[model samples]
Target: MQVAARGPAALTSGRQRPCRPACAGLWPAPTGLSARCRATAEVEADSAVAGWEEREERGTRFVAGPAFYRPESCAGRDLAVLAAALQRKRTGRLRVLDVMAASGMRGARYLLQADADEVWCNDLAPDAAMHSTMTYNLCTAAAAHAEAANAAPGTDPAAANSHASNASTNGGSSDHSAGSSAAGGGPVAADGPAGAEGAAARRQAAAAWEARARVVRLEGLTRDVCEWDFPPLPPASPDPEAGVKAETIASSGTLGAQPSDEGAGTSQPTSSSPGASAEGRTEERPGPEGSAQAGPGPGSSAGDAAAPVRRVRITHADANRLLTNCFMREDYYDLVDVDSFGSETQFLPAAIDAVRFGGLLYLTSTDGFTSSGKRPERALAAYGCYPRATPWANEQGLRMLIGAAVREAAARGVVLRPVFSLYSYHGPVFRVMLRATSSAEWESRHYGFLGHCFVHGDNYTLGWRSLAGAVCRCDSRGKLRKSEEEPQQAPADASASAVEGSAATEPEPSASPDEVKAPGPSGAPTPTSTPAPTPLVVAGPMWTGPLHDAAELRAMAAEAERRGWTGTGLPKSAEPGGNRAKSSRNSRPLQELLQLLIEEADPRLAPGFISVDDSLSRRLARPPPRDALIEALREEGFAAARCHLESRAIRTNACMEDVLTVAEQRLGIKRRR
Candidate 1:
């Protein structure tokens, strides 16, 4: 289920997979599906979209399909579960948030599929608006696929039935109390005053909102497909006679959504803000009067006027400000996610206050450490959670605190569920998701940890339990685990090997006191001889040659020192008689490395040169020396000359591969070493 690749490969399905992009080459396959179903899942062509949707409607919830975004934290399991939860909880329309909304792909899909009452989407950058637009376009494409599939002979049955059911359900609508303010229709007005100018502004805003909303609805088309129609956004409504104005609807662009029913307009679009620009790239939408109508596309006005409803506005202001000022009021949000990248605990109490009673505060704590060079217990205490270190052998100081917090919350009648988790690529960063209940629990549990820099340049969990506590507590085993575990031992070995191979060379470890050579021989003073200092020797010319430029050479030596190679003996000529000896000593290792590199590349260069392991193998395998690299280098006519230089550098203990790699990097060569 886990995939790790150091390079790219062409799969049997003809997808070019790149190691960096990670998921760039995968085609999601459904489990428990027959051959027919599996074939249906590989519906990459635009033509197959319709058929795929038809099959998807009948597929079980567990069925995995090709996803545009399926990373651990961004998409895949977490997103799927979230979507299903939204659907199950919604009575009429879904209220959703796309937090870290990158390009709005996920939100756009939701708009296209779910019957959302309102959706709010926000991002850290302005360029995200373009992504929002694209997501909306894709959603439209998905919708079209659904419509087309249903229109087909056999696949159409399920869609037709669902449509009929939705229509009937929409017809008998009551007040949707359970949904957010954006969902159930309420007051609809501009935040400004009522006047000629106000009305014009409202109209402009509405027109813009509708325009972007329509773009979100047009998610069915690929970039190649042309749009059909676009509805103009409506204007904002004026304030009441008492000078009270309501909030306007959030932009569909924010969340990249359209009307859920496609036929009805009851759902309020909240995925994105109206200020976003779609750049006019959506499939055609049928206008009110005609089957197909279009204008400047995403910005065009559909030319319709209707009074709007009032709705609670969604904005991206600082949560601390909102909560402290009481602008949004307590119990305003059913679910509030304060996903601060560094620390979410600072806003925990405020978030808990914002959510309604029995609501969920999905908070993330990425700062996992304790004070005084240990894990603190205050994190769990703040959230009404208690630690239970079962199988005590598996418990660490920091982990115990987390477990304790959950247990404490449970004791206080707070249903705590530890959900999805992820570790950063280097394993230094860890993200944990927890669902908390009750304001008291949330307030009490809000805490932070101070990290400790341990020996060997490693960071170990350490923090104070609380203001009252002196230090964090941990068992002897936990301390040993922290200090003794050779977690980085393998990586260090790999690095050593890489260094050795590049030098055509050799390698080491361990030491003894006798080998170390203590000061005295047989407890007697040992005589020493003073050696003459070597003079400097430069490689370049007199005026420009580094040898003559003492100052420059000194500067170079200082620079090398800054990079951890401390010493004053950098210039070969700095020591007169020993200049060549020192240079040879330094250059010899490099030559050895180059030799090793040449040896590694030899099989690829010479057709008849068989690898010793390859020769001994009983099974048939491709020639060991034949490599794509050799072919690529030869195609460019640099193979023979470069190989000769490489071989010489390896044999002479001079640096070759580094130089080659530098040249390749400088030239921006796509080929890998």
Candidate 2:
């Protein structure tokens, strides 16, 4: 059968859901950077401390010693830095809270590279020695960063780091404050000023930037939460910033956990440094116990003028306890980064509340199985979405994550929208940058169910209120069967209009099943009284909105270009999937990746992509070049582009028939049938 000349006009026309969101963005449903530097990473046989290793990434050198650092994950870090830097540029005061700072590398970068006003790095590592190592690396790194914050943009960071190291060692005292930047960055106000960019700028320019970091001892807390005998985070001090500190563990703060088996019903006691002033609103952390300690907190001397005052704090506690303490203290951060190993669903509520309303949340997930449709149980347990395997499971992973955050925020009477969604295949990691808004303008339409038919090649979204009916056409076989042949069922309730008084806003194909004529022997639309019903696989309570916000992508690309972050992020010696043995001939620049992401944001393009090789190339005697085909599709008035999630795939408003016609006519490729 010859494919249809015109694809679904309604899908392409109407410019299809104009969410080219502006910078401030629109909630209509309601709502809502950095690092690309490639510095050769040289690993030190031994760091300053015994048995500790040092490594460099994106031009910043830090202690990689005995901590969880994945060199291949540098691309994600690069993105994180860019995002943090951009947030700082916009918000003026960038204070970051690293929930699980396994080596403090990310936190160090936040201070050194993103210009974070202060960073509180916390890890659950019970190793006192390893904890000391993280503190030292973070403080010294912060010291150098703070000193060079105002130095010419071209200042050599290594020189400043060397100077700070020499100064700290000259004192022969292991007190962390010798070259600390923590003393002068001002108090860690329980409630920080969110939009005081003008004031923050003046403060930054008037005095030297400071980098200070401290790691606390946590021996009482059990390494395993299943034990439950350990202490939980105490309740908040009604007004802690005013100087009345809350008791270390008052036992009143509730754990805002979801139905996750991560860990439960446990807590830990917080201690305060002896003889230190209350000027720094740090969470209570126990200090040294008569010189048996691994290291002491940053210098308590308020008069250290040479150190230029840094403000970073590191601790040994689970993410829940640490963030709960922050929430109790009202010590909200400009950005909260949660880079969990599996999924961050359990931490979403606490992390969301810890942000300073309108701040950023950089959340990550590495559990591909949850969204692979192989384990709908895990998906439901984690993000409340029942995911099933689809050709586009990767994109589903991202959407699943965003939908979780959006629901969490809305439930808390806050609003959240995605700034960007990223998926990398190394660990099959999924990360998203979300901007939280104090203004609540969430529409249920944005979050709903998704359905894909086994027979039909198309995907559809079901609205919250309009759930009963979905209508899908055709098959995934890439050819139209003859009208006289037995017909397959239409997709299950893909189009909500299957029932009366339905309010689903998703548009349908311009042509109806019962058109003026029946399909010829060649592939074409057929006349039928009613569409056939096909088996449908549905997954939802997930985000049904555009994958990305284009306005934000434009800004992020500009930020990446400005930072000269051009490397693909993985080491040139390593393949993108982190295998050094594999050839990396296909590695592209960071800008190229960003550009593809920007293109993927085209609102006219639909949700799932059509795999060229999987869906189309087999049908054509000779498949057309992907780029040329995309160009031709565009010329034919269809919105089409390269899909970033899957290579050799096309994301378009064009239906299967239209695509087949394009291959049959524009490119002069003969169909096999």
Tell me the whole-model lDDT of each prediction, alpha carbons only. 0.25, 0.52
Query: Where does model 2 exceed 4 Å of error?
Result: 1-51, 149-309, 474-526, 529-531, 574-588
* TM-score, one value per model: 0.29, 0.64
Report the C-alpha lDDT of model 2 over 1-673, residue by residue, as the tens digit: 0111232122111111111111111011121211221111111111213323334565554555467777667667776777676554443345688988888878767765565545777777756434544554565555554344334233433334422232211101001112222222321211123223322322222111111111122223222110000011111112221111112111211111111111110011124334432222222222112111222212111122121123455556689866765665454666799999988899999898777554678899998888777888888989999898987888889889999989988897656777678787767888888876554446455677766655545565565443454545443222212212545432223222121101112343332222101112123444465456564566777876677766666666776664555655444444354444332324445677778888888765666777778767667787578888888777655667887777788876555655666777788888777
Candidate 1 C-alpha lDDT tens digits along 396-471: 2223223434444534434333322222221122333343433223222212221111111111111123222212
Candidate 2: deviation at residue 488, Å? Answer: 30
Q: State model 1's lDDT.
A: 0.25
Total backbone collisions for each predicted model: 91, 46
- Worst 10 contiguous positions by lDDT, candidate 2: 225-234
